[model samples]
Target chain A: MNISAKQGERFAHAGLALLLLGLLPLALGPYWLNLVGKYLAFSFVAVGIVLAWGYCGILSLGQGVFFGFGGYAMAMFLKLEASAPELPDFMVWSSVEKLPFWWEPYSSLTVTIASIFLVPIPVAFIFAYAIFRKRVSGVYFAIVTIALSMTLVVLNIGQQGETGGANGITDFSTLLGFDIINDAGKVAIYWVEVVLLLTATTLAALLLHSRFGKLLIAVRDREDRVRFSGFDTAMIKAFIFTVSAVLSSVGGAMFALQAGLVTPSLIGAVTSVELVIYAAVGGRLSVVGAVIGALLVGFMKSYLSEHFPEIWLFFLGGMFIFVVWVLPNGLADLFRKILRVKA
Target chain B: MTFRRGNQAPRRKAVIPAAISIEETFVTFGIFVMQLFNGLSLFTILLLMALGLAIVFGLMGVINMAHGEIMAMGAYTTYLTASFIEHHLPGLMGVYLFIAILLAFAVTFAFGYVLERGFIRWFYHRPLDTLLATWGLSLILQQTYRSVFGAQEVSVPLTTWLSGAWEPTETIQLPLNRIFIVALTILVTLGVWYILHKTRWGLRARAVTQNRAMSSAVGIDTNRVDALIFALGSGLAGIAGSVFTMVGSTNPGTGQLYIVDSFIVVVFGGVASLLGTAASSFLIAQMQTALEYLMSGSMAKVAILLLVITVLYFRPNGLFASKVRA
Candidate 1:
């Protein structure tokens, strides 16, 4: 099948899958709903990876930096909201007098949401400009981003009073005036996440199908040709990187809202690498593959950690090796191959 | 322009004399000496780590994110050996330092070989995948070590000769460990140079690194070369880890601290060049340490990274990049 036709057929399948997933909360318990919520957040990150890595051929190993940025942004706001007449719990414990200058803007939801997109975009733009402008492609680019993520983690850890360090940002009482502790609030948050996930997926799909997306792909495949055609490859890469960062930030924000905490672990090198794993294991050639990969990995993580925490990492490692060795194109390709065989 | 140039020569001549008071010159010289030694000590540790990373990343184009983990493994090995010596050997603890380092190297080398043969061999062309796979491996290794080693920092007991300091003055005292690392680094560098330039195995390795297909056509076992080179690189990391235990604390997650710095050194040194790697390592370490002494640690890091960025901006191929295709 041609690319568009394949996309159309996959879209139909995805629509059916999402319809079933939306109905899952009604049939399942709160624990399962929360699990699905986690998957949705991961799916958001996966979508970002599809744009940055899958379509653009930029293998960014530090999506976690943006994820952490968004999470920290939302967490800061939530922390402010939870703080009644007094400062937030961590700040109080740390003996901070007034809210720091950087924390001031996050008090407003408008600012937080704006920053959810703005912060990571600028960071991505500046970093991408610095790196891509120098024509640092392939593994060198990956290393630079990995270093950036590590720097963020170290900065976060060092700023213990502001960031809560390894403990991260937690202990949220409310989000947008709704008591998060209540069951109804939890369900509401879950539904909000579901809506956001679908919106992000649709937007990403539309963007990828656009002319700009084709150019991005062309740049990935033949950089010299694209440059000869008078298009600046670095600018295009920076744009895609910025878009990916914004989407990752949105995912991070939703994740912080769902988990009610944000930590350095969210933005660490490990998490960034995990994002790439999801994209690779899901099938980097297609958007749906990323979503499936995220869902499967997230599901496995939640269930396996709960049941057998000790062996969870081992299972994760085994899955990575399995995906790379046995199914290099990821689970999506495996499914396609099986379908082809049956046909 | 001609008039200004003529006028500026006398001003420049006057400024030179004004800039160089005897006490000021002496102070500047003192600072230079201090920074040079600081740079050397920092270079020792960085060279130990970067040498291993350079071989794996440069030769095979495999970004072993878990190189630091291998170093951690070496440190843990040293710690365990020290413990064993403390319990059983008693008086033989000092004598066991050499044995402990050798054992550390052997254990990590074996681990590296198994990892390459089992996992890394398949992902030779896929740098990004190797990164993710190795990162996953690092996590599992870290968690496993945490479970086994009990998460707290383990101290490696140094021999009596490896302890204390060398004093040139009342205020100037250099630790024995730093001197030991410097000596070890020199020996390791010489050993590596000899192997790469002198031996038949090294020739095969170099041939394979340059062109895998051509080397195979010439009857070289490229696969064995890859495995051995990887093992050797990992063994070097293990030695670095063992050396690190003398100056710092060892924990499951200690590897995280050096991984970023090592990568930066590798990149800035021009990936695949040992001489470049060593030069860049010294340059970055000296600049960073000097800046740290002059300013704050974070600020120094920021400054060093900026310097790297500027250097890379001007010379995208790095300071000493090979003329081979990436």
Candidate 2:
């Protein structure tokens, strides 16, 4: 395809995506709108997965740790706001004499917002660097991430007095004095999420089409060759991992705001792996495809679990096998092939 | 300090009273000894699971995420056998445990063989894809078990001979079941070692693992080797699962509890060495047990995980990794 034709197709695609998202609020009730917002929250993680796992070849099975870091930060702020002048209910129940030092910073909205990136970005960078710097990749790297996520889940559950344990930081109705549970607030949050999602998708697209993205693909295909060419391959891998971490953190913060709670279960190994499937199903190489994948899969899961709870896993698991075996490049590729689009 | 239960309460810095009793000291000693045995039993289970994982990974470079589910298959097989013996072969109750172990191995071995032939062979070169695919298979298997056996946990009833503990000391009652599990692990380990070293198939397996092209050129059916080794590794996991029933109840999700830990054992031991897998499992199990004595169980697990990741940072190939050209 020529440049003008390709650009025209891109515009058409973006226009369709916008129209679809714009129609949801008008077409659906408050309840379904809220659910799509949750799926949009997850798409952020899926986008990050595309960059890190798809481009950089780092299959981190622990993105949930970063997601939780963002989520818990947001939750702490909301909880503190809800229970101002007194400890959060769980803390009081657990007989904590004073608010933990970590919880103090979360009382401020600015600090809480900053913390979504401030904490997880550094941790993600350091963790990814530590492993990639030593040339650990592939299955080993994946397993290490799994262990990391598991550790976080255990630690979060173990520190019930401080972290809200398995029940998580729920029972919060307001965010910055705005009643979040109301339908108006829910619709507002949904639009805000949609705007943010579009912004992230565009930014990710720009990044993936850049020279750095080319280098990332090179590193994925042949890291040793990239290293031999004087590139610090570890730094390259870590950078994208950290970038993906940032996206996941933002998604997680959104998740807390929209979902009304953040729990340890949201950041366990199982959830992390599930996050990867969102990218895999969408087409790991396509930014917008990942968003659609998350929405599609998320909708299927919600609908299936509610209606046919017994067989949802069968469907989900079947999708995984089918994607690996047949639809390796995901739905985007299938669509492209059907349309006879040139790569 | 004299009246304190050893390893139960965390140590405090407060000065101890001088009126200590010898019996109290003996009890503390006994508890410590019991903790060590507990670690041994955990180490055995980890080793069994990791042995199969390491072997499959080393030979074909395929990550079998369903290996844990395969182990669960063994546990369920044991559960089924126990129920069958209870219903039809009541007179053979004493020997049923032994029969179940062999049956579990046979069942999972055949399952592994079919799984590899049907699914795993396609992704031999795509290790990461294999990981995700097998993970999907694991979820499918877990759901299948849940549908068949229900979500509730099932336990294999121990024979009359296996139920009681040995009173090594007045305070230290070592469970007979745990001791039996440890012995079973040792026997299995020796059997695996003997097969790998003495058998012609073992030679062919090692040859293929070391250099597949050469093995193929030398007229060894490398695909057959791949299938057989995969099955054997799965059979080892089956045995591990069978033994697990004596220690804990079997649930559809039981395999998930061990999958991450076994992966750690395989990675921490280095992917290439069987001896490394064993050593790492022993190290991790002991470290976790010791840490649990000093802190909460969850914290202990976190500490071990952090320690393993930290160690991997410096030694990515694992602590005992043999030098390979890659």
Top candidate, metric DockQ: 2
lDDT of 2 by residue, B245-269 (tens): 9899999999999999999998899
Each model's lDDT comes to: 0.82, 0.88
DockQ, in order, for the candidates? 0.41, 0.82
Candidate 1 docking classification: acceptable
Each candidate: how many clashes?
Answer: 0, 0
> lDDT by residue for model 1 over B1-326, one digit each (tens)?
22443343334345455657666555454555555677788788888899999999888899898898899999999999999989988988877778888999999999999989998998876777787778778878887888899789999777898789887654456778788888989999889878988999999999998889999998999889999999999999999999888888899988878888998999999977899999999888877776677676766776777778778878888899988775
iRMS per model, in Å, is 2.0, 0.7
lDDT of 1 by residue, A1-343 (tens): 3344455546545763565355687687776676667677877788788788777889887889888888899989999888866777887778888878998898899999998977777778987877788898988888877877877787787677788978999899697788875777767888887777777777777788789989989987888899999999999999988988888888888888878788898998878887777777887766777877887888888789999887887778777767767777787677666555222
Evaluate candidate 2 and give its CAPRI docking class based on DockQ: high
Measured on C-alpha atoms, candidate 2 has an lDDT of 0.88
Q: For candidate 2, lDDT tens digit of each residue in A1-343?
A: 3334356438545864665576787798888899998998999999999999988889999999888888899999999999998999999999998999988999999988888877877888888887788999988889888888998899999999999999999989898899988999999888888888888887887887789989999999999999999999999999999999999999999999989998998899999999999999988877777888999999999999999998988888888899999988898777666666666
